[model samples]
Target: MNKKVLLVPLAAMTLSLVGCGEPDVDYTDNTRLTMRVHVDEGSEEGNGYKEIITAFNRENNGKIRVDLEFVARSGGIYETQLDNDKRKNTLPDLFTFDAPKCAYYAKNGYLYDLSSSFSTTEQDNFVALNRYQSKLFGIPIQESSAGFYYNKDMFNRAGIDVSGITVDNPWTFSQFKEACAKLKALPGLKGAVDMRLDATADETATYLLYPFIYSCGGSFVDSTGLHALNYFNSANSKKGFQFLKDLLDNGYTGTNYGAQDFFTHQVGMYLSSGWTIPELDNHVKWGQYFPDRNSWGLLPYPKADDGTAVSCNGSWSYAIGNNPRTDKSNVVTLLKYITNAKSSKVITQHTGMIPANKEAQVGYANPGSAEDVLLQQLNKTSVQRPETVGYAQFSSAFGRAIKYLKDYGVDKSVDDAAQYLEKELSRLK
Candidate 1:
């Protein structure tokens, strides 16, 4: 037998003896809840999830105790664990999942229907965008916006003006390309942009191509089924793909670069989320490369000719495990405690992510913090990723088009890519 299993009976005896001396709060009398946090162990934001759990524990006193489980960053592994837990009927009382994955769980009946649990008053407390995006799946605990974080010093050295840029006044896609061209022409900065295109990392597809698809008014799904493949083959998608291909073809982006790698080299500009700010702050010594700390600034994603400034917003949601023994009422109570407005603010404050609740945003205003500025800018112009079932498969299909474009350039035939995407999308239905 495992040594840990052998010690369990002794551990139970010790707990009994310890219980005799302490006042036992009958949390079970009301609702004994166990919360399991599904987190990516390697991420700094993962630590923030633990901090939020710690804050929740301290505030709950003895009324509730949560158990946290850290998961590997791989989405496939995370899904596998969830599947196993569901089969064994050992689902956690509560858990966290990415927005798109949560949508799949909600659609498949694997997660509770949170739409009924939130009151009108509570629902109204969240940002309008978040309310509209995540209403049915799970409460959003944190939010981050996708955009370009550029080094102003690099821009100035390249004779590119930063004065007219604002969150509300972001450049058009054409203008963004022009600026990048100028930056690339600079003496030392060979690669002026970081458009993540690696197939191995999901961010290339999620943070890069997803927004482009949206900006072009194309989508990964239609009434019939997943349409990402068809969408990418469409004339509009082809144009968008060609634009990105042109960038890579012209040597505007770094060689062998993904999002993380590009930023690590202090590349001219990077397209990523506000959540990256904290990591950059810790990793890059600002004074070493740039003259001003304020040299790094974020802007909304550039628009297409139609003037739609598109951006992708991703967030985490609290979920209930499929465990049969968990009391429904207890689970609801636990969800309430963890996703409350104050708790949401604590998460935002610590993690540099936007609070899911609109009321929680009030805490960030007037703070003059970089995160606050990013959140404020993002709120005005952002859209959530498609929260439908089979989103993973859909996103994967979409990624293929990106890879093709990045590797072969726009000169390659779109017909093959389109046919493959359509075939893959057919499976989602």
Candidate 2:
């Protein structure tokens, strides 16, 4: 995509007024509620949520109006907005949040208790890992998993097999490393893989380090209040850190490729969200030179030596704010409408994101649909990221550790790093 055209944040442009006007007079009297929904600018144009909103308005006759605000991809900007809103006690009626941050919001009592509102049947519609307790904080909107996306043509040129293996049967960590080495050794082939070690990439921490931590059975923040820095220095975490460092040391990765650049240039394998596949397929140039039309393939993160498969799932949820409503019933009705099965189908179809509702998943898995193959692959494997209030701090600490390991190499002593990690982990308590 053109950076100048595509780089524009959805929020930067106001919603076109054509054909959309304020609710008519009588419709407003039934129950007037203004909800601010945070959405990604990328999804703003053909977002599934728009269908849900439209269905909701039709059903309710415009009693509830949802105002969506597209947030930039910048973490700092989003955090600042949330913090400023929280301090002013002026937050949106509904917003979307992912793991770690969701845990933080729930822990701080910033969201409404949604457990009673949804049924066991409704909750069961979501994958087990996607659901959370603690006052039933938020409703899972779209769930996503992270993994390696390899160039089939590149793999074939190097004579590497790219068949049958999926998120469930991904290569072992060692196998993954070897694959990278083989690719790197191939004459005239591009680099083996692009692991995001660069500080500038937003996802360096979230997508890259978390899987390593999970693979080693290390928690970002332990119950006793340990953080990433503390986890990094531990013996178990040392293995995970070494795994990443070794990749960098062995020439499998470098600072050149973040998540976005990996697939775009067809450079070695890339680690990223499943939603990225559709966007990647749309961008790549294809022909005789690019023999692999289905040039991309998905696999879960490599397994640990003990054979445990782990991958992180990112879920954006619906949360209600503390605003008092004259007609609370209307608010609940709106919530149900937005999260209903029909809305979920639209979301899954358009965005390629896994639906939070079981019924909606069927739509993606219908015969002949590319999504069907991906859904079947993801369902058997994939897990939600650790949900904890100190996830942000944990992520930051882990990112720093990754950078340190990449720069210093695996041979570096863990003493200083471990000590630094332990101190940061203690702050979560």
Candidate 3:
């Protein structure tokens, strides 16, 4: 439970920002700080954070203590709580936030400038850190990569072989459709794939599905992170979205599938991230279905027509609040403890996410393991979503556009979802 030696170098750093005005909290007290995280108190992810905090407290003993707050993510409750806190000026000394929100939070002054907490060399150690306006704001808790999960049994029944498919050598868009076709023809299957369209209400749509756009060399925003015109509505971007539309049009996937359809054996393939592995394991342990460890396999995202294999990356990260009066040294001490290589491994162990710290990734995955495959994607093909102050708007808008495609297919004149996406992003400025 002891922290790694990584904290020694970072602990000496100080917050460079001056207080905005009169401090809300007692600047004299730096020992007792509060931190909020988005997870149910009893969930695995929540327990992981608790374990880290407990160890941190035990190590610090009486010198420093962290009061933990659990803000459940269900129904956008976590984000809503943070919004309420921001309005009330009661934000915690430290908090965990989604990576995509880094821009919006930094732009709105919700996070502290963490450039000092992590040195350039240290920052380079994490797979992805949240930065805005050329300043570091948040440290990634873990790196993320998404892939297709195919039922091994179903694949075998369809006489299909996926042993050659890998993160570097993935199926082409057409090959993916062909595989779905083969799977659909099999008897007693709900559908060929579960695209997770049911999860469109929140960030999942944008986080998980954006690869479809990027694989075809599309982008949600330009390099400046301030525009989403031709970048989002280009012919290449349209081709990416068109692939999704074709899935629905061809009856390869549909809107009616439940989120757990894959686990329940209702689908041949499910598009998801590393977290799905734990879900499948839990379901098997609970006797929900009798599938052994080899019953399913992970796949890299399909390649675009241009032979590009792009996958999603980025996850929740720890960020100090904007309160300049708080004891930055104490808060950052805990932040380094929570995000250090050892902490990264512990958290990823429970959550099934890849460790963000490069050191943690070392010896973490076995050769040819599922985690290895995901690690390869994160290292080689994964891309973070567009960093923009308008990301929240873009996430919601993109999710809605995908839903629009689901609600109204190509035949209904909704095939131009990219155009709709472009139009929505156009209003961001």
Candidate 4:
């Protein structure tokens, strides 16, 4: 058995060793180094990370010792904590950050460019590595993609056949609406779908909903990565938002529903990510509504009449801070080790997330399985959120637009939302 590592308080390690190694050091150095890694506390993902760190510490023994530290992760708490650390110049040697924040952190000089840490071939193995200004700033801990989860039993009873649907040949917007009409007419279901509108208050809103815009040929910004006026408010963008509003107008789905409505058979479909698998597989109430995993199936995101299928992608990642006192080589070693194929596989198995390492994704190779559906969409059809320093503001603007569509109706909402996005973009300038 491996020896245990004692947890360290982030406050205790505020003063990182400065000027010890100065700038870059040899990547192969075997120096005895002490490091601290900070991750969000209280999550299954966190547990998986702890396991990786413990195994790493045991393997390296006295040559390298890493202490794990946890900080609050919900309701902007984690972002606030990191911001405070930045101001104090007490950031940890290495830390976890959301992929969308890559530009913000790198532009602020809080992160070190890791482009040289891995060769081109090795870097290609990761599905998504956070980059800014052509420099790699963070490596993905895992990858993510979202799709519609349908109750197979519900579809069967509603006389809907989804057997022919797939990432390449997904349902069109009209077909999806027709299916929703049929499913909502079934007995016992409150609605045809649960879009999880409650997620609007956080990043989950943008992560899951942005694909709608893409499916309809809408973009948040232009090629220059600096504007959202016509791009965000274009005719195509309005069509997508209008489709969502039509669903509400037709009473196919609503803002009010239990978070587990889909799992409990209260809704025919749920828009969610791979993270929902663990709950569906092991929830205490699983036996009540779902007899087995076969009771449900995964569906790719629907496309517009003239567009192709699309889904959202990205997740949290590990990044090295620009603390000159810390040994760059040591932190890079820890980053590569924890995100390797073996370590990634372990985390994916524990969290139901897709692994960042392509090699680690072998576990999902079973064709036509639910897990396989997600993996296929991730590899083939998913797109990343805008990688801009202004992404946070853009997400907020889009989220508010969603709410407006539901409350004030479509045309005004689309125009109003686009105007808001324009205003936010101007502020970023």
Candidate 5:
């Protein structure tokens, strides 16, 4: 467990900004530190990052200028792309990535260890998923909550009242399934769909499915040991997998689970993230594409087999990439600006994501509103993905397992899939 050393003279010295309230050092040098920021440029989130950078540069007045390096997501993929760039000594000065990646990146020296970045008091103010062990790498810039979104018009027409389904009296998985059946029986109504918009993407499938498994009393990783083999195929996990298979086998979901179809009354319950709140709030329409628009209903994910309600709480995070050529001070300053409460509020507002700042959330989340529910789950019952260094591999493997179950209902092939995942993760040890 030896740490991989990057050997940059001043790279490890991050500016401690807690109560210092300033960027630690003023630039009489004002050398116009031109840092390269790598981002998934073709994406909406990437565009949001671009907007933040433009604003930051304007505010700083040429002290720091960022050249957005539009990295295509095709080459080698997450962490692999960064790893490849690192091997060539061409890594960008900064990159935005998933929060779960800090474990892998920090352990192997792909990131600067940020132990000095936040004071103990500031650490307390941070959301739960941002801190990892003793060395923090990724700062959770934006977070999200996944839940069941039902069409209120459909529910009322079906003579079903979902008005009382509060955080305290949420639906159990079985109860939710039964309700979906009743809703499905209504003329022209289809059953619920998985929250993940894309059925084939590995990351979304596994991310959306974990809450069900955790609610059923199974975990994908034993955090104490950071291992997957012994836990992923447990009995409760099988029960959870069976539930997913049932969703597919009974013809409950497919393409129409999307926003447009749900808005048009083609679907009953739409399971997805809190990002839908704004659309519902504004009564969004697709240029006469859909005939009906009902106010959407939000509820926490259905209760598990054991009645333990759970929510997936994680976000896209930013990391200081290893770059010997860039000014370490400037890079850290940008990181501070990107994650501080003010910058975080701007990013969340521009990107339509939930803020990681505790105080900032209170300003946006009205009492008992959809935003309020999302904040409550993120703070209370959220289960973050395991912080193992093998997370990228684990997510891909688990995603494949889900696809296997979808392609061919939970059969003997699933046992083989579990074995493959276990073997893949064991190599990391």
Candidate 6:
């Protein structure tokens, strides 16, 4: 039997060199690497990642071994844990993080450069959005987008036509507001849920909610990336904020999310990724709305006043940690295997997320499905989260400011919130 191994959390290089050419034990294992993965347990992506790890280990047996650490998808707590790990230098050899955090982590000197190692043409095979300021700090394993999941039963009962809420013909801000108003009129139904307002939705405001601003022809930050004062507090931005305020202030959206949420028809709409979809195999047997599959649908983000389509895009990707001890060759090997066309196909099949590799994108499973709709939205209307060093602080402050509005009411104007956000940003700068 192989000798017992003591896993060093993130030290791939140091641990790999323990013996003359292998571990001191008779095991003769050449390389051992630790990996940390963050995706909800039982989630499609989580299951896909686990499968990938298993196959990788089986193939690399006796050559390289991996110590896998799985973490849940709680944005607030998970990021905090990662930060603590970084400070204590106890992070795994590599870990998964949302691509939006690329700038923040890279700027703070906490990642390996993957872009520089790839050939120009080879780089073309991967998703174009992984680079952070020209340097590839991470590789996107999958992709998701901003969209709406509405209750068809609620629509039918409210006598609202759900046709307009499609990718080709998205809901306008006014129409969306009107629909929410109608949804509230239904008996025993609460309203909608703009999940970004959830307290634990730390990075969500930056991803899910920003589309509201973008969909309204409003700018959140200037080209200089140093200001949100005029951009966020401006007249155009107010139009979006006011629309959101109306959703809550007028009782078109519920404050809390529960089991009785969207699926139960308690809330008419849920704004999130396709990952929220349940197993379609059971759809025919039972469900409130979308029982026929064609009954329910996904829609693009509401268009801006000028009819400009917009959406939020990105997902958890793999990045090498900045710890001093790293097995560069082994790490690169693992990354390449996981990101290539073959692996991408395998992963997308399990995660049901869009593929990050260009070739695999074409082969992504379940075309013309809810997940496909999300992929299409990403292609048509999506925008990447800002690759700025201040993104973390920016998201935090913005989330709090929006939560204040969501918690209070319309009285908490976007103008005041913008001012408060500007002040918070200055401290971070």
Per-residue lDDT of candidate 5, residues 109-213 (tens digit): 777666676667766666664445656777777888877777766777777777677666677777777777677778876555544524546577667777887
Q: How much lDDT does candidate 2 score?
A: 0.62
Model 3 is weakest, by summed lDDT over 10 consecutive residues, at 14-23
Regions more than 4 Å wrong, model 5: 1-81, 130-134, 194-198, 224-226, 249-251, 254-260, 278-294, 325-330, 406-414
Query: Each prediction's Cα RMSD?
Result: 6.5, 8.9, 10.6, 7.4, 10.4, 7.3
Q: Which stretches of candidate 6 lie over 4 Å from their true place?
A: 1-32, 39-47, 57-67, 71-92, 126-128, 184-188, 192-201, 204-206, 222-226, 256-259, 279-290, 325-329, 363-368, 406-412
Q: Report model 4's TM-score to 2 decimal places.
A: 0.87
Clashing pairs in 2: 226-425, 227-425, 229-421, 230-421, 230-422, 233-418
Q: Which ten residues in a row have the lowest lDDT in candidate 1?
A: 22-31
Q: What is the lDDT of residue 130 in candidate 2?
A: 30
Candidate number achieving the greatest lDDT relative to the actual structure: 3
**lDDT tens digits, residue span 1-429, model 3:** 447566654554433233334346554588888899999899999999999999999999999988899988888888887887787677788999989889989988899999987778888888778889889999999888878888888899998888888887888998999999999999888889999776777777778888988888877777666666666666677677789988988889988898778877888998888877777777445244535667778888888868489888998999998764555888888888898899999998888789999999999888787778899889888888888887866777677667877566522322344455456556665
Which window of 10 residues has the lowest lDDT sum in candidate 6?
A: 21-30
Report the lDDT tens digits of candidate 2 across residue range 163-239.
Answer: 65655566788888878887897765346876656752355456655677567765544553444444556666677
| Superior candidate under TM-score, 5 versus 6 | 5
Please give the lDDT score for candidate 3: 0.81
**Cα lDDT, model 5, residue 162:** 72
Clashing residue pairs found in predicted model 1: 91-322, 91-323, 92-321
List TM-score per model, in order.
Answer: 0.80, 0.79, 0.85, 0.87, 0.79, 0.77
Q: In candidate 5, which residue pairs get closer than 3 Å at backbone N, Cα or C atoms, i.e. clash?
A: none
CA lDDT of each candidate? 0.65, 0.62, 0.81, 0.80, 0.68, 0.70
Candidate 6 CA-lDDT value: 0.70
Winner on lDDT between 2 and 5 is: 5
